[model samples]
Target: MSQHFVLIHGAWHGGWCWDGVIRELENAGHTAVAPTLPGNNPDDDLASVTFADYLDAIAAVLEQQQEPVILVGHSSAGFLLQAVAPRAAKKIAHLVFHNAFILPNGASQLDMFLPEVAQILIDAAMTVATPHGSIASPHKNVPILEDLIRNALMKDDSTEVQNALLSRLVPQPFVLFNTKVNTNDFLALNIPRTVLFCKDDRSLPPGTFLKMAQSLGTYELIECPGGHETLFIAPKIIADALTKITINPTFHAIG
Candidate 1:
């Protein structure tokens, strides 16, 4: 049977990042669409973008599908799945978190990171802030350092590949990280959820990604090999894993 997938990209990346994955999915007789969220474009105004913009953009995409799609989010987009689920439940057949963040209700993405790591991101955001009288607000967005990307996201890839990846990245809107969300309505929905974890992911502390996946209460666990940027580094592998997991509905329950 043929299936439609709506792939959402993580922070600092545009929908182009999923080109490889989309190709593999299409080759398998499956259809997919990867939409670059608002503010991710090179010319977009980062400061004006809010958390709601991301939700609205994603919701719009889901609403347009003729049939319910296998909604998949990568990296920070995991929370986007939670936030959009309540409003677009009927449009989503399953929730796939590809090494994505799953935040608790009312908690910001920053809260999920270790203090030191979180501070580094916060400080990076502050560095590009625009002065607002006595206070400063993050306006230029958070820039991902090359070393950090090479070490955490594409550690296993070649320098040329890493450099190519870095050249395409845009600053991520800081507001996306600091915004708190409530997933009460989402939690109540009976939609199927899956955590497609890349085992080699080193962006967060070891075991952190799985811990976040555990918070889904009941979810299908699909582990593959790659780091945080597996979607870009090993698209075929990620696509294969996605195809396999969505073929069945077996899930593991947690407390």
Candidate 2:
């Protein structure tokens, strides 16, 4: 059966980032929609963006769909999954977290990242001081970001492909990572969930991610070959795996 897939991107990326996965999913005759979050928009005021803006954007996307969608969150969007699911629990068919971060209540994404690791992005970013916090320097830190993404986030693509991706990367707002969400009702939501783990992805340290996925109470485990950027590098694999889960969400052990 054909399914509707809503792919949510992580920081420094927009709906553009899901092109590959969308193509593969579409090829399988499944409809897919990926909404670019407020802060991630090229013309958006990064400093003014907030966590609520993201939730609103996601909710709007869910509203556009007539049928339940197989919701997929990537990277930093794992945090998005925790909050978004509870709000749109009835609209989502399944929660597919692809190499995403899963944070506890009151803890921001910064808490999940290794200080040194988070520092790399922090030190590289140039944010302007605001009443709330700060906004990042758009493309001003691309040189450092290039090295970071290559060595950390994505490792399976060619230098040329990575460069292309770097060109599209935006300097994400601090608010997106600094804000924390309440997952009290999220855990209680009865939606089926799954984690798409990339065995070779060092973007999130090994052993740590499985522990994060396990925190979801009960979730099916799906493993595949590739790194944190597995969705881009291996779209067919991801699309196929998502198809399987959306069709039959069976309980399994963490990969």
TM-score attained by model 1: 0.93
lDDT of 1 by residue, 13-99 (tens): 999999999999999999999999999999988879989999999999999999888999998999999999999988988889999
On lDDT, the candidate that comes out on top is 1
How many pairs in model 1 have backbone atoms within 3 A of each other, for residues 3 or more apart or on separate chains, i.e. clashes? 0
Q: What TM-score would every model get versus the actual structure?
A: 0.93, 0.88
Q: For residues 1-255, write the lDDT of model 2, one tens digit per residue.
A: 889999999888889888888999899998898889986777877667778989989988998889888899998889888998888877898888888888777788878888987786566555544588767665333122667788777666789878877888887877666677787768788788888887888876678888877678777888888887777666788888888783454654444
Global local distance difference test of model 2:
0.79
Single out the weakest 10-residue window by summed lDDT for candidate 2.
Answer: 137-146
